[model samples]
Target: MPANESTNSPLDTLWRVHAILWMVVAGEGLAVVLALATETSSDRLTYFGRLSVAIQWVMLLTLVAIYALRKPLSRIRPQGVAYVALCLLLINTWVTAGIAWLLMRDVGPMPAGGWQALVLRLTGIVLAVGLLGLAAFQNHWRARQAAVQAKQAQLESLHSRIRPHFLFNTLNTGVALVRRRPEEVERLLLDLADLFRAALAGPRQISLEDELALARRYLEIEALRFGDRLSVRWELPGVMPAVTVPALSIQPLVENAIRHGVEQLPAGGEVEIAVSTTPGTVVVRITNPLPHPGSHSHPGHRVGLNASQVRIEALTDGRGSVQTQVAGGRYIATVRLPVGT
Candidate 1:
């Protein structure tokens, strides 16, 4: 199975805002618990305030160290990353505890025990907390890996569904042309072969220009079948953006326009494809005239549109979308992709 292109490691969570906030809360909770256990009722409040300062300092410093080395940590296995994080926490805790002892040894009421005993207790607490954090990290990593695997499996299934449907439809079109225009059958087969090559390439990204070229080839094959009945209008930008889209993303929408829109009309209608770009996104729209309500409508499972939508969303981490709506008596299928994807 191919790995996700944009998946982040579990260790990466350390730098997230919410995760950091949670860690701070956990540290404060630990300080409160320790204070209640080791201090008298009258002094527990002061002990908690002091312990929170030391604990929070240790946690924040360890987090900083981990973030600074995040690139190297990412290169290591998850187990190794967890071990390193635990080690950092322990080291920070010991160092912070030592500093607190040196600074405040004579300032206030000690926790029944002397500085050495306090150091021992702090080390024990840190080791226990570190182990618990390690376990949590392992669980999170396993869960994330499982989710990625499930998503990849779904993408593969969608791809499988799309390939057979595309192949059958193209083959039927070839069959229709084979009996009438034998010479054109060769060109149609060539195009079909190219499309199949892309469809079978598995989950991957292709340049926007390459995707458009593939869509154009598919349209060419359909043109041979529709002849004068099928007319296409293309509106494209002068300079295409440097971006990648999932394979076969655009072609399926074109196929839907022809099958559901143009093919239903007696005097086949025009299919308009327009591509435009903004500062951060690229949009493609396919429009075809709808047949009258009483006229014969093509019966379709809408597999292509649904598959395209799913594939785009999966590949783009939900940043891209496929949408369809009816306006001005025309059915439009729109695809939006984020730039720098």
Candidate 2:
């Protein structure tokens, strides 16, 4: 299996939870909506109440079934999803059948096998409709997964493109300072090593502290090149919260500030990086002097920014975002990540 797919495999989610409970809750909500739409006013409450009970029973039995068969299910392959769906179907069928039996047991003068026959018919209809819905859900989820994988691949490609150009520039800067400032060259190489390590760490997330450190290293290397012209100011909290961010997410933004903003001016400029949090969101703002008009094309400018935005959205499941603009002679980039506990 491909590494990304392996890392994100659905099979690994078999015995794990959270996503399944969310699915159950969503299914119950849809059932409530359907009942409200189709059932009459007087019967709506009773139907809704019965459905509520049925959902509870179904969820309870589903959990039991998962507990009993978790070991075997874990070994089930890519077919794990189908097997899980089948398990839920059977559990729902039996639960519905039991409820139906209890309701009809005291009915007047029914034939000996009437309840069984009714249950068979009801179960057949329920299974038919339920399986169709499950199949639709599976298809939709697969399509979404495919799209996420494609986006991740694109972001990785963007990351790979960034490293080469950045390394080349930093190396040239190192060569320039090699004879004049040999000791600084050692620090420069160490910073470069740290920057590339985070870059090639794949598409996983790292802590905010670590990401900030990576960005600091990148700025440090640029500082070596620009010396006093490339100053940086950091506005960080005294107590850094244990939040996570996409690897290399902040560094690329800092690199953009250095390459396009400060480097364009003869006197150069200072870059400001501020980290703050509000309620459940972690906000990072990087500000640098805007480049002169028509000076040069910033290669990979949009590419890197878009990739970083996509990665943030993907990492936070759309709870994070990026915004950039040139305002008041400063190019400002802001990233907001949902704080994770």
Instruction: State the displacement of the C-alpha of residue 180, model 1, in Å, after optimal TM-score superposition.
Output: 3.8
Q: Which candidate gets the maximum lDDT versus the true structure?
A: 1
Model 2: per-residue lDDT, tens digit, 65-110?
7667656765665446565756686767677768756785685345
List of clashing residue pairs for candidate 1? none
Question: What's the true lDDT of residue 116 in model 1?
Answer: 80
- Indicate the residue-level lDDT of 212 in model 1: 89
Quick one: best TM-score, which candidate?
A: 1
Instruction: Give the poorly placed runs of model 2, Cα more than 4 Å off.
Output: 1-78, 100-113, 141-145, 200-204, 292-300
| lDDT (C-alpha) at residue 132 in model 2 | 79
Tell me how far the alpha carbon of residue 265 in candidate 1 is from the true structure, in angstroms, after superposition. Answer: 1.9
The TM-scores, one per candidate, come to 0.81, 0.75
* lDDT tens digits by residue: candidate 1, 84-202: 98899888988998887778779866756677887787788888888988898789788978887887887788778888988888888999999889988789988988998998887
What value does the lDDT take at residue 294 in candidate 2?
A: 78
Q: Among all windows of ten consecutive residues in candidate 2, which has the lowest summed lDDT?
A: 1-10
